[model samples]
Each structure stands twice: as C-alpha cells, then as structure tokens.
Target: MKKLIKYGNENSQYGELYLHDTNCIGTVCLFHGGFWTMPHDLHQFDNVAHELLNLGFCVWNIEYRRIGETNHKWRDVFDDATKAINELNNIKNIYNHVNINNVFVVGHSAGGHLAIWLNSQDLKIDVKKFIGLSPILDLEIAYYKNAGDGSVEKLLHGNPNEFPERYLFGSPIKLKRKNSSELIIHGNMDDYVPIKWSKLYHEKIRKFTDISHLIELEACGHMDFIDSKSNVFDVLKSNIR
Candidate 1:
C-alpha cells in the first residue's frame, strides 16, 4: 500500500512511501524536477512509484521546499532531501519488511541534479546508486545559458559569479564524489535540458571515477524519461537491477 509520511515540519517537505506486500528487494527514492520552482511537487512521481513497486522495489516519492514558497531557500531543499532519506531509513522500523540498505535514487531534471548532489554529500544514510534523467548537472552552464527561464538565478539569488560558493555547494558537477555509482540518461532531442549537459557531466566525472556513465536516447524528448511506457523507462528498469 502507498502511505504518506512527513519528514519535516513544513507541509511541502514530505514523501509518499510505497511498500510492496511481498518480495521487496530494496528501496527507490523518486525526486521530481521543476527547475527548483513551485509548480512541481511529489505528485509528478506517482506513476513512477507504482512501477517501481511492481519491479520488487519500495518507492519513496519526495517533496521538498522550492522557490516562491514561504521561507524557501536553496539550502532548505537540501536539508529537506536529507531529512526524507533519513526518514526512509527509519521507515523499516515501522514496516519491518522494508530494507534500509541498497537504497537507489532516481531523479528527473532539477531533481536529478539534487539526487546527484545528495549522493555526493556526507550523509548518515548511504545511497547505493543514483540515476539522473536529463539532469541540470552544471549550475554554471545553466546560469550562463539562462536555462529554465532564470531558474538557477532564482534559486541561488544571484549568478554563479556572484555566488560561487552557493554554486559550488549546489552543482552536482562540482560536488560529485567517487563513493557511489551514477548513471545519467538524456534524450538526444531534449530541448528543455540539452543532452550535452549529461554528456559533459559524464565526461567530467568519469575522469575522476569510473562509476559514472551516460546513455543518450535517440528521438526522445525531455519529458519522455518520466513516461513509464516509453523506451526510456525500459532503460531505467534495466539499470535499476
């Protein structure tokens, strides 16, 4: 059954946990991407959650504070993400059947950036693998290109030149660690987030660690990565195991 649980004080900071009734292999955390803005939330991952459950994995669909919300700050989003994962680890106490280890994170667009960033952090909970679907991995590039209608500036409250430390703290490209494996998938036709971002990021990270990989989908667009019926979903499923 799917259950909603709070991991933070604010209403926006919560997650929906999908617990498989039998033979659950591990946990998968889903993060939705809306360019760090208010228009997106956990609801975007509903279909993905069910599909993960069917694949013998429990799902945690997370929601974090975004810009345009009260007391919203970019760091708060990171804090909320950390809280959600920590809560997921403790969820095994409630369900008893849920596995705390072998946790995988799947993120889309902006959320993919966050997943990569989280994987790089020094957190108490360990993430086994990170899957980024069309992530905005480079904040400096996204800032210079004015991607997402100035979403990066809005989140950082300034350009990368003005807030280099913030960009260093937030950008997955800057924060990537060699501890966990990461697979980045991008559509060749993605107009929202160009395929080059994933390719460049993969190239950069691969130089330091061999665990990073990139997969480019032909004729696929930005949103196709999240579509369960799409070929991208098959690619994602094949990698999850």
Candidate 2:
C-alpha cells in the first residue's frame, strides 16, 4: 500500500510513498512526464513504482507543479522538485517503518530532465544512480527542434535567445555532470522526444564518466518505455545497475 505525503499546501505538491515489507533495498524517487504540463500526473508511474517496490525498493512517486496549473511557472516546478526530495527525511521520521538508503532518482521524459537537473543540485541526498526514460536531455535542441509541440517554448516562456539564462540553468545537458552512475533508456521509434538528443547527450557526458550508458530500444516508442507490460521494462530491469 502507498501513503500520501504533502510537502506543500498546493494540490501538486505531494508524493505517494510505497514501502516494501522486507529487504528494503533503498529509495527510488520517481517522476512522471507530461512535457511539464498538467495533462499528465504522477499516476503514470504507479506500475513502475509497484515494480520498484517488488524489487525491494521504497518508491517516492512525486507530483510537482505543472505549467497548466493556476499561477504556475517553470521556476515553481523546479522549486517543487527540490522540495519533494528534501522532504524525504521528514517522511522517514514520521513513518518509523520507512527506511531510506542508497537513493536512486528516476524520471520519464520531462521528468527525466528533472531527475538529471536535480542530480546536479548540491542537495543533501546521496543518490547512487540516476535514470532517464525517453528523457528530453537538451533544452536548446528541444527549443530548436520544437519538440513537445512547442511545449519547450511554453515551458521557458520564450526562445533560447530570449531567455538564455533559463536554458543554461534548466537544461540537464547544460549542467555539470554528477559523479553518480547515470542510465538513459530511449526508444528508437520515439517521435515525441528524438533519440538523437539522447545520443548527443550520451556522447558528450560519456567523456566525463565511463559509468554512464545509453540504451536504445528497437521498435519502441516514447510511451512504451514506461509501460510495464512492454518488453522495454525487461530491458530497464537489466540495465538499472
């Protein structure tokens, strides 16, 4: 069973905590993707969370502020991401059964962008690994390619030339790489987020750390990687190390 914990008063500022009964491996902070919009929520990763629980890992399926919400801004979404991770200790203290160790951050699509971005932050948490599923790695490329149906423009509120600071700070590719091992899984047939972005990100980041890997799933699309029923899930399990 999962428990709901609120980090902020807003409707979007909470996470579902799933705890395993035995052999608690560690904590997995899971974030979903909807191009940083409200059309999608944390429910998208319920299956993945359950799988993680079965793997003996506690899951924190986080829901952060989205662009479509009232008075929402990209900055709020970023702030909420940090807030959610910072709240992990509180959750452990409140629920005596909750034990968090060897943290792993995982996100899909735009959430993948958030995962890597959060890793770059000097947070108190010690994340063992970072994983991106069909993630939007490069914001500049995303802006140029006009990925996510102009969602990137809508996210930063303008073009790279208009708001260069936002791109420089918000984009994972632009941030300095962390020492933790990172895994990127993208589908070859993905139309929503180009696989080339993943490849480019991998090529650049691999120079800094040899532990990073990019796995391209054949005949899979953007959504297939998150679907537990898909064969891509098996690949995800094998490569999570």
Q: Using lDDT, give the best candidate's number.
A: 1
- lDDT by residue (1-241, candidate 1, tens digit) is 9898888789798889998876489899998999989878878878878888988998989999998898777688888877888887578878888876778988999999888888787777778898899999989999999999999999988997788999998888887585888889889999999998888888888888898889889999999877888788999999987
Q: What is the lDDT of candidate 2?
A: 0.85
223 Cα displacement, candidate 2 (Å): 0.4
Residue 81 shift from truth in candidate 2, angstroms: 1.4
TM-score each candidate: 0.96, 0.94
Runs of candidate 2 exceeding 4 Å displacement: none
N/CA/C clash count, model 2? 0
lDDT (10s digit) by residue, model 2, range 1-241: 7899999999999999997655476788998999998779999999988897887778899999887888877688889888998898888787656656678888999999888888678776777888899998889899888787888888888899999999998988878887778889999999899898899999998887786788888998989867887898898777553
lDDT at 130 for candidate 1? 86
12 Cα displacement, candidate 1 (Å): 0.8
